[model samples]
Structures are given as C-alpha cells and as structure tokens.
Target: MDGDYVIGGVFSFHYYMHTVKHNYTTMPEPLSCAGSINSRGLRFSRAMVFAIEQINNSTKLLPGIKLGYEIYDSCASVSVAVNVAFQLSGGLDPVFNTGDKCSQSGMVLAVVGASGSTRSISMSRIIGPFNIPQRVADVIRRSTAKVVVAFISTGDMKILLEELSRKPSPPRQWIGSESWVTDRDMLRFSFLAGAIGFGIEKSVIPGLRDFLLDLSPSKVADSPLLTMFWEEAFNCRLVKSEATDRSVCDGTEDIKTLRAHTLTHLISTSNH
Candidate 1:
C-alpha cells in the first residue's frame, strides 16, 4: 500500500438485525462488506469517490502525495461501527480480546464521517489513538484527535449524552449539526452548555433553484430517488411548525433561495 493519505470513511447504509435466528433475516456478519449496497449508502459512497477524484485531480492540495481512502459501512449499529473502527485502526481483522490480537499498520491517515453519533462514539475509542496528518503523526504517539460531528440526529444525541454522563469529563467544546442545535430536550442536559452548531450552508447552485421549483415526478421519471425527493420537498412527513399536521403533500411550496444551511445558536446554561 504505497499510499500517501489513508482517509478512513464510515457510513450507515443499511438496517441492522441483531440475530439471524430462524425468525430473523439473514445478512453479512460483522466485519464483512458482502451485503448489497443500499440507496443511501450508494449515495454516500459515490460522494466520497467523487471527492477523492477531485482531490487527486487537483495539484494544489497534496502537492506530490496521493490521497487514498478505506471506506466501511457501520450498518446503523454501534457494534458494527466498532468492528469497522478496528479495521480502520489498522489490519486488526477477526480481532478478539482473547485471540489473534495482532494489529497491523492500516492504510488510513485520517477518518472522514460516521453520520450517527453512537457509531462515532463507539469508533472514537479506537480512532482516537491513530494520529492523522502523516507528517506530524510520524513523530507523535498520542495527539489531539480532531472529531467532527455532523448529521448526528437527536436520538443519537441522547445516547451520546448518557454515555458521557456516566464518566463525566471536563466540559468539552462541542461542534454540532443543525439537526440538534436547538433541540429542547437536549438543552435540558446541563453538560451540553457552550456547544456550538452550524446550520445548513446555502449557496446559489446556478439554475438549481429554478430546477427544483419546476421539478415533478413526470419530469424525473428516469430517477426514482429524485421523484421521492420531490414529494419530500412539498410533503410533511413529520409535524410542521405552527401549522396543522397535514397528511397530504402540498405542491404550493416555494423553492426560493432555500435555507440550505443554518445559523449557530449557543446553548444557555447556568455555567459555560
């Protein structure tokens, strides 16, 4: 593996089943990627491939070094994420505390994403040790792991908080996604004070706004994903703010300069 940068990636693309007992469905076991890829997982994996291509094509970023990656699926489970994390830590396959515990040098220099927080937390215990940024990593054994949390939903936030609360550390500086920035339930957690979050980042994607406004199922008959997204844009799957909880899709929505991103709102607690 004559690679320069080993960027480890994690994505949850499928639903996980606990047991494959006669009643349960069958699928690949932990530490395996033999299962069929899901739509969401495909989307994420493609994005990463596109990004790596862009980075490789660019001469400015890496200079002479090539950028490479090792992407794994978390299967939407903490146990699965932990399994993926060890693969990222190095070549620790079929790893058990009791047998064949030899860890090899993995090809990754840094990790990219694990959309769910529980997965992120479970993996962090392993991902935290490996120093990213090869030049500095060459000399240091232990360094600050740069952790970024994005698209971590409210449910995952609760699990993350509960885990942290058990072994309460010093107040951590938190960076959050718009998803849970203003969640009232989370605000009640005293430990989350001073956490900062970013909302969606909006940009005029030249003609994209117009395209979305005019988008319809008939227009995108070739793509099923786009068709469903069209409905999502105008349909209220969940409760809408200050409005009746309608069970129908209203096509009267404005697709203007969409609030693509959000502004950060600091949590006000008794002590920062």
Candidate 2:
C-alpha cells in the first residue's frame, strides 16, 4: 500500500529458511525460505493492513494525508531482517541522480515489526543511525519454578512445546505473551491446558471476513506467496492433476465453509 508517508514492517512469515551452499568460485544462490508458514505472523500483517485501511478512510485521523506501508517476510532469520531493514532505509542502493524517482519514495517514515527479540534488535541497529523513530525469551525444565512466563513468538514457542511434550514434567502454570496464548494451534498440545495469558480482545471488524474469503486461484496466479497459502488453506492444487499425485482444486470448493471465526487466521486455522 502507498501513501504520503510509508511505514515499514517485517514479520517471520516462514519458520525455516533454506540454507544455500555457496561455492566461492561461483555466484551464490539467493536465500530461499522453505517450511511451514507462520499463521500468527500472517494474521498480524493482515491486521496491520486492515488498520491502515481504516485510518486511511477516517475523516479525522491524519485528515487529507495518506499513509502507506511496505511489509517484508523475514523468514525467521536475523540476516534477512537486517537486509530488509536496509531496504526500508534506502541503504541497499544509493542513487546520486536527482531524477531517480525511487530514491524519494523508498525511505520509510517508521518501521513497525520483526517479531522476535533478536530480529527486532537487528532491525533497530540498521534503522537507528538514520534517526528513524520506532515503536516496539525463555527458559524451562530442570529446576523447581512452578510459574513460567513465556515471552517468545509462536514459532519459537512451538520448539519449546515439542521438546516438553516428549517427556513428562510436573504441572507448571504458564503465563504466555499475546503471541501464543490464544493461538488455536498451541491448544492442541493438551499439556498446555489451564495455561493463562493476555490475548488481543476478540472483536469483529466489519467486512474483514468477507475480505479474507475473497480469494481464488486466479487472484493468486502471479504471487508465489499467495499460491503457497492457497494450496495450504484449501488443500488442493489450482492446476490440472497428473493422475497420480495431489488432487487439483475444483471451482466448486467454497471458502465460506471454513467458518468466519477460523478464517481470520488464514492458512492454518482449519482442517479442510
């Protein structure tokens, strides 16, 4: 989205980043991120966009002035976050000519995200020198602390949950950050029952459900990100089947069946 002043955001959309082998003799391959998508991050990004649209349409806030944003998927890597920070700051490419249109619009008024502690710190360093304003851990096992306060993102918390799920630990009360406490996926662990934490207050945003369900294979045709999300959400291919592999998506598949409450989370919210 574009406006008079643009905000920058970085989120770990993917949990794993593919490691590329670089033979010093040849040009290195670009970083590739592969693995499960982070539905929380996707939800947060969408929320940001939704808020921006609301602000843009308001008659009072920033009246007559537009607000824009540029959001990036860090792929859960600090290096990628730093790279995007530079991009947001217009540090990656320096333009000497005054006629360059990109140089004027490239700089962001402020940067909003990069969820984890490490990634957020790295982004601060890159954008800090330019005086760009910003807004914006764990443990466990072993000892005998019955109360645990977790301050990690959903992706990082999943690792800890998997490790703990393998063995039996004495009942511990968990206090989670907003990131994982209300997450529907985290509830499946069963062991996390009775865990308590603060979550964003549930509220209805008019038209949000319809806006999210408004998707089709044709809309995702040019975007690889959306294609991946589409395949994961509907569990079907948008293309013709090869007779022996995954089934192709038929036009008859209805997204409305996924339930409005669940659709807010995007990819991982439903079993369908």
Best by TM-score: 2
lDDT of each: 0.52, 0.69
- Candidate 2 off by > 4 Å: 20-28, 58-60, 91-105, 127-146, 161-173, 184-194, 239-250, 259-264, 267-272
Candidate 1, residues 114-191, lDDT tens digits: the string is: 867667887887543231333222222142433334357654566566665665445546678765775766776686
In model 1, the runs with Cα more than 4 Å from the true position are: 21-38, 92-105, 127-201, 204-272
Model 2 CA RMSD to the hidden true structure, in angstroms:
7.2
Q: Score candidate 2 by lDDT.
A: 0.69
User: Candidate 1 has what TM-score?
Assistant: 0.42
Q: Which ten residues in a row have the lowest lDDT in candidate 2?
A: 92-101
Candidates in order, TM-scores: namely: 0.42, 0.69
Instruction: Kindly provide the TM-score of model 2 when superposed on the true structure, using C-alpha atoms.
Output: 0.69
Clashing pairs for predicted structure model 1, backbone only: 6-109, 199-262, 200-261, 200-262, 201-261
